[model samples]
Target: MIDLPIDLLITNKNKDKTVDLILSFLSKENYPAIQKITDSLMYEASGRAFIKIQTGCNKFCSYCLIPYLRGRSQSVPVSQVVRQIKTAQKQSVKEVVLTGIDISQYQDGKAILTDLLKQVLTETSVERIRLGSVYPEVFTKDFLDLYSQNVVSNVKNGRLCRHFHISLQSACDQTLKRMNRHYTIKQFKKTVAQVKKAIPGVSITTDVIVGFPGETDQDFMESLQNIQEIGFSKIHVFPYSNRPGTLAGQKEKKWGEVFKKTKLARAKKLRDLSKQLEENFRKQFINQTLGVLIEAKNKQGEWVGWSDNYIKFQISNPNLKRNQIFKICLS
Candidate 1:
């Protein structure tokens, strides 16, 4: 652990040091530490645990400051990740979420994200392994095939969770190019189609940014139409706001910033679509049995938790214990 633990509080530059500081507190000398613990430090007395498997982003998308603020992508060793998950399992943790700033870029020597996942699955006995936001470029045939065989087929036993949160900022090719996105909309569509075909009843979610600088009316419409066509289970919508020192921020004056009112209006349109899409995705699972990990009882005296596909739900079963998985049927 580093000597100056207080540095974590002052600035964002010391992202790597913060990991060391967390390990110093959580682990004794005999125990090991993951270089990266899911994106942030999130631990609860419930069944699920979050571990940052990687940190930082190499994809300096024009609008984002994550690369400048957090530095380049760095992955935790596979052995360390497995060790941490095993320790959590010993503490009765039933679910482990592998998270990061950009886990899709995770690399430790020759091991990539898929390799790390395989190691975790083979070495640990965590009931569920959920993933954080994965960049679209990582979804190669090899990766999808591995997921189909190992994660989708083994859903009955609750291994890897059957949910994908893809980081797709825009659907219009021109807007995406301006935003410096690595993959085209067509590539993303193909990947999603492949995953959907491989895993039945899978939940796919995504993020979208509306009203980016210089985004035309046609561009906005394209995003809306394409997103609806893709049919994501849910979407997290964001209005474009300039981040200081980023490429988009510098080009704001030249590109002409999107009007505040226009941004809000566009955001509303996307959000409305999100609601419809979410309802449509959830409709298929109605009355179907799902594996749910009971995390806690809410203030309403009902057990609240998430289904294996990442749906938040509540049940009124008094016999259910905290930190346990149960087969629950949706009504």
Candidate 2:
């Protein structure tokens, strides 16, 4: 244990002062990202394991600690990933999600996501694959070329045609600059435009940080407007946390206390907007039959899983086993 301090402020859904439990966001815990993917695949998985090919980021965005915490851009090697996918086939797992702290940046020589995709689809027995998250800058022409023409054309099997999370932190150029994000709003828009043109019904999701110390109302409004315009399938919104050893953490000593009340209010608002966006996004997929890998069965007796496009499916199949893949009709 790193021995987390007991004084950490724990809160509640109501935003009121609360009790303890450092129960991390399961998605970003201290656990190895690879293990997380594997566990999700083995237990929570409906049918396939998530293969984490890379760890860490060299980008070092001002607000992120991934470079410090997860370490630099080292890959798990393509051969290893291929081996794991083969094991997945023996387990009868039908899908594989390519995950990484920086999935788009995974590279070793001429091979990148394009090369990885070609291998997984053409060589592997996994029937479907979905990306974890990718930086927009990494969504190169090779990616667009495949994602566009393929209305499932280039896919050999188990590779998604129109899905990716493009980490759009903010819609305002100024906000993006302050956040140390590499791409501008214009660049992001241009990239997304090409993706949309290439793949109809592409699900582009993003992350937006609200209440950065210097963000003005205009900046906030601009981010919201951009979210609406992008028509994101899901928006993972977070209130900026001033973690130690980072630039934002360094500023915490100088800048006055961030209004916890206000920032949470903003997060809540954005979450509401996110749900609305997801609802609208889901409407397009009503009656859609998507390849689903059953992850876990809830206590409510509903077995749920995510489609290749990451659309959640709540199938009411009680006898279904976890880590099994099936094509389920999306309502």
Candidate 3:
């Protein structure tokens, strides 16, 4: 069976001339090539807008194929990002998620991710700005300070989401080394501690990959211990999958593989731990007032929305409307 680019081609057929240019690459016949970066902006008329500030990645994590597929990191101009956010605000988008393959590596001339964020907050009228996953190592003191200020002041006005998702593939140093993760366990812990101290009541979330090649039982135990100690509000756990053409996959070809059952068992354990941590985090906010952006009505007719710190909640108020921000006490 052959897979064609029919859906993508059709979607962009009349909207973009670049579609024909891209289709030529998939055709069997040789055609003149034109080089250009794909559009980085994405939005809906009245909902959350996702703006891609950059594309590709420079971090070549051992198990990932993103670098190979997307090429080296490249960021959109800061002016363009600010303009896109303004457009989203004009379209009545209540929330905007600044996304990228590696947004922490974003740079346009002298501007960095911090500068881009500042520009958005200062210039755009978007009600809420959410960030995509970022590397813990990139959360420098200056960035943390900026975030602290924003969370304290902007959160009340619905300008920023007081939540951060950092990617921590493994908490065990040995496993992280094998994964080619640059930071050490100690460094990661320090970074997390600093962030927590700087931004009180902020929600910290992370991703953990279990069963990486060469991970031992001791390593898994250490990972579990570290995760419990960190007390992340949310954890995204994944069992390591061997992606061909990557460093880990190549190493697996040379060495033996870890048992699938062992990987599943470890992943399940971490997922259960994640649930406990999430519940604890949510409990802390009980009886506290939070700013929630009403999203939609559930099947039971209850209004559903997300708090500034990313907590999903439902209210029984029938008069509430979507796209409105309201302060509600968590019960």
Candidate 4:
């Protein structure tokens, strides 16, 4: 086994200072060092790219280790983000996903995520802009107002996709409180309502965790009911897992654990509910015209792409190339 010298700076949240320390150490040891803080624009051969505008997380949820691992939030300058998007556009990239560890907390000087979005719309010629997962609490009225203006009614020319995947760990207030999620179920529903009102036909997707420690049957039922009522286009259900060094993990270690069979049963039930909800959402678009971005041909030689609402679609056209946008009626 090779032994390597490794130093961790968990206490130092400033990335710049961390880099400086590493460089100084390397220079003193007469070792060559190269550093690049800003990431270069990357274009996939399929004409898609992901632009990271921020990094780190400050939300210390009970079950999440992200805060400990990533430290506080730090945003990339809007100018840098716009520069990368423009470069990707020049390379013929049709879609770009604005990603971050916690995008809702993204801020560069006086500009927030909404401000950065406006600049991207005004400056870049990218066909579609997809946002990564965002926190529901950050969906303020001002943000929604901004979104209402730029969201393209016509998918062909729309720069922003009509899909939002907000993180909702649990719908039950008690369970959410235990997880330290920082928002109530009612607040989440209100945000969802606001989003749907601002952007008609917008698809909302979410993440749900079941069988968290101390969750009662009543809590699970509440979660299930709320999930069904929300009518998410897609639901990603995950069974709670104990992550080392997390608050939940420590608590589980101290207390008796829930039965594995029980957790599995809960997960399966939520997954079934998710499938039903997805089908229901899909049925709503039948015979309706939707815009799709042709990504690639599937194993059966049928062209496949995602709609603006993030629906997977199979087109009969064999002549279509990647990155081309086409309108089709869902049947």
- Give each model's whole-structure lDDT: 0.82, 0.71, 0.82, 0.82
Model 4 residue-pair collision total: 0
Clashing pairs in 3: none
| Estimated TM-score for each candidate | 0.87, 0.80, 0.87, 0.88
Give lDDT: candidate 3, residue 111: 90
Per-structure clash totals for the candidates: 5, 14, 0, 0
User: After TM-score superposition, what is the CA distance of residue 70 in candidate 3 from its true location, in Å?
Assistant: 0.5
Model 1 ranges with Cα > 4 A deviation: 1-41, 152-158
Give the winner by TM-score: 2 or 4: 4
The worst-scoring run of ten residues by lDDT in candidate 3 lies at: 6-15
Tens-digit per-residue lDDT, 1-331, candidate 1: 5677442242353345666756765565422333334334356788788887888899989988888777899787888888888888888898888888889999989999888888887888788888999987777787777677767324445487889899889999988998999989899899889888877777899999988888989999988999998989999999998888889899988877899999999999999999998888777878887778888888999998888787777999889988888888878
lDDT value for candidate 2?
0.71
Q: After superposition, how far is residue 299 of candidate 4 from its true place, in Å?
A: 1.4
Q: Measured by TM-score, how close is model 2 to the native structure?
A: 0.80
Backbone clashes counted, model 2: 14
Pairs clashing in candidate 4? none
Q: Best candidate, TM-score-wise?
A: 4
Query: What tens-digit string does per-residue lDDT give for candidate 2 at 212-292?
Result: 756667778888887788788889998888877888678754543457787788788889999999999888888877766
